[model samples]
Target: MSKTYTNSSTKFSFALRLIVVYLLQLFIKAFDYSFGGVFPLTFRGMIFTFTFVTYWLTIWYASEYIQKKISHLNTISIVTINVLIGIYCGLSSTVIYMLGDTYLFQNGDLWEEIPFYNPELSVALCIIYLLIFTVYAYVQKIFQLKEKEVNVEQLEKEMFKSQYIALKAQIEPHFLFNSLSVLSSIVHTDQNLASEFIIKLSKTLRYIIEQNKRVLVSLEEELKVVEDYFFLLKTRFGEAIQLQNDIDPNVIETIMIPPASIQVLVENAVKHNKLSQKKPLCITIALKENLIIVTNNYDKKEAEEISTGMGLSNINKRYQLIAGKNIIIEKNQDTFKVSLPALSTIDHENFNH
Candidate 1:
């Protein structure tokens, strides 16, 4: 709300500045005609200064009055008001100048007498002034439209950032809980295995924290984090969790993705299913054409059905927004597969490592 007020104030300030500059130009023109005239220019300067200032003040007041009275006025109404304002200002300036001449300069035997006031000239001046005002209003309207477009783009970027941060926050707690459970199970049986798990977990967490600040990470960096995550999962499940990858080296160097996206999909597969010696969890990561595919064999035990479905939904939303592509899901009776479009980048070898 305070920001809105500030913006409105800034807009008002801009309008005020424009008006001041316009008035200054009119004053300068008046001085050029009066003070820079043929003979001694004092009396003419005084009359012209008074006429110019009075005209500017009257136009400003009339415009403000019309705008306030018809705050929701249409374009036609505004133009009508402007035309009327131009006529009134021009006529008022002429009348004031004529009155000044009659009252003060009646001893008209000066070196050269000013010309008599002409009503036809005043009418022509009003028409010209109104035309200029109309053009100025049209230009102002164009600028206002451009300003609105900029504001809209800024707001959308802000909204995307906010939603991205919220989604990241949701996944972190879910990830931490699962990883800590795995660590707890391994602590008592194999101390060295538990230590190794801790190291891998630390690396994964570090990656998440560091990459959360960025919107994208190289595919290679993301794959490294996924490999560390796979180690932790493999440590927990032993031979029950089988993982394979067939990623293209060429694609890896030129593609980027949101950090932890693959990890989330893999984690979802583990969380929603059962892993045992007889029914192992087989997960495969492969790149086919322009798609990165993650597939897992479905073998959920009756007792273990703890799927929330948020991870896949979140990843889908992020991918759609970032890449302008849909995350495709293919499901059969025996397997579930997710295919994400690989996001291209400018640097060919940026993700080589």
Candidate 2:
């Protein structure tokens, strides 16, 4: 469908260009018979023809060039520009016509013989033709601008679709099953703890559901959800998993980051590394040099239990679409780190939807 539309648009544009090219010739031919026997088909007549067509094409495209540069278009501005071009084109065309006849054609005394040789009539015709051509140029510019807007909207829609798929991928079945299995075992022995577990589990699920709700979120809001997710993880893993948050409190309310970024990083770290009381998988989140840094100790597990491998990739995509920024990743034998650009509060409204 898009191809068909593009082909049709190309055909229309080609046909329109041909018509514009011939319109000036038509205008020149329309006045050719006015000279009759007084001005024959000679070098002088061809000179007038060249002058009219050249001047017409020059002003016509010049108006379009102006249209492209004017960021804001309105009736008054268009009218002002059109009137100026019309006057310039009309006065200059009349002078060119008179000069060509008086000097080149040696027909200065024949203006009375030629009915269409009146200067007022010549100027009026020039202004009228210019008005028509300039108006067409203005409308063509408007359509091009509208086409650009449509393309941008289509691009945004595609980005949002990717965001939805990424959000869905954040929910892990293994995490859910393991959390539920742990919950069932402790409900009787630790009723109070079980209740707390249920609450954190609900919050974790709710956080997943609310992903992609907005393009940007405050650090405070994102950390609260991350805390809920961490609570569930710690409750299940006991001393085997630990998270240390050292984000600057002063900027928590003022700085923004992509949603689910910290949670995804923490989840990714736990999935890829070994975790036990002997060597705990320690995850740290901190604000350093205007960056939200997530780091985890390296402990190679012979085999990872579950990894869709989309966690970090999805975070990178969301950050790009939301803030036009890229997340930085650095890893060595001892540690894996991801650095997310900290956004400002003033720009939150720019990415809300």
Candidate 3:
């Protein structure tokens, strides 16, 4: 409805401008009516209308020609072309009026008596028309540029949203498969722990299902989900994994992060390392300033299988589009760490719909 109103308003404004130009042309031609005292009103009105229409049509054609053929012309070139076109249009109108007076009015004497070959008047009118065209062209160009900028901005936003969605899709299934594997291993050995794991898994799944539909979630809600995820990891890994969380409750309440982000990083650490009685895997999750830091002790053993880097890569891409910042990864012989910015700082927002 707003769009329709805008279009209607634009059309109305254009019509109003054209009408004003026509009236101005009529007023200028009214100066030539002094020869015959109060010339027949009908004849005068016809002449005024005809001259206004001719001038308007010529100006319109000149504008169209400039837009189509010589749009690339520089300011000086445009000015020159505009002036030339204006002179041609004015001269043509005057000559047509003279011819009309001679043939239709049967007044050859009137054309001969009056000095109508004044190039100065034609040049002055041409300059005035040229200024009008220049202003109109400049305004039109500004509008076109603004429209193009708006379109580009909208496209960029859509692309970012699509990329974030794709990244989310990649992370969800990968994490779900890993969680199910852990659940399967625990179901037979420890039924009680397995039941708790099922509850945590359900909560995690529910959170993912609900939050994935949103562009952003509250920081407190995401952190609660992460804590639930941590519980499951603790139950599965037992003493082999040590978890430390040092998050600011204030920041947690207001700041948001991508859903399941913490789980992905923790899972990455566990999947790619050996955690046993000999080498304990200590995972630390902390929020410092605006960053969420996940660091784990690195211990590579011959027994554990290495993981493909897809999870971390997807997380990185998601952060890139959402936060406009790269996900920072730090690795050495002893430690592997990832630093994520808070969700409030990222592209997450309330869903438009």
- Best candidate per TM-score, number? 2
lDDT of 3 at 169: 46
- Model 3 has an lDDT value of 0.68
Backbone Cα, N, C clashes tallied per candidate = 0, 0, 1
What TM-score fits each model?
0.49, 0.58, 0.48
Local distance difference test, each candidate: 0.68, 0.73, 0.68
- Candidate 3 — which pairs collide? 256-343
What candidate 2 gets wrong by more than 4 Å, as runs, is 1-172, 305-309
Looking at candidate 1, what is the lDDT of residue 338?
95
List, residue by residue over 1-353, the lDDT tens digit for candidate 3: 32354476578647755776776565555566633332335675567566666666556755766667876879688667777788876676667666777787777776686557546546656766777677767776776676545544443554455445434643577666877788889889989988988888788767755554554556677667777877877776678888888876766777766666776677667777888756778888888877889999987666754555666766665555455567789999999989987766334442212
**Model 1, poorest ten-residue lDDT window?**
344-353
What's the lDDT for residue 109 in model 1? 39
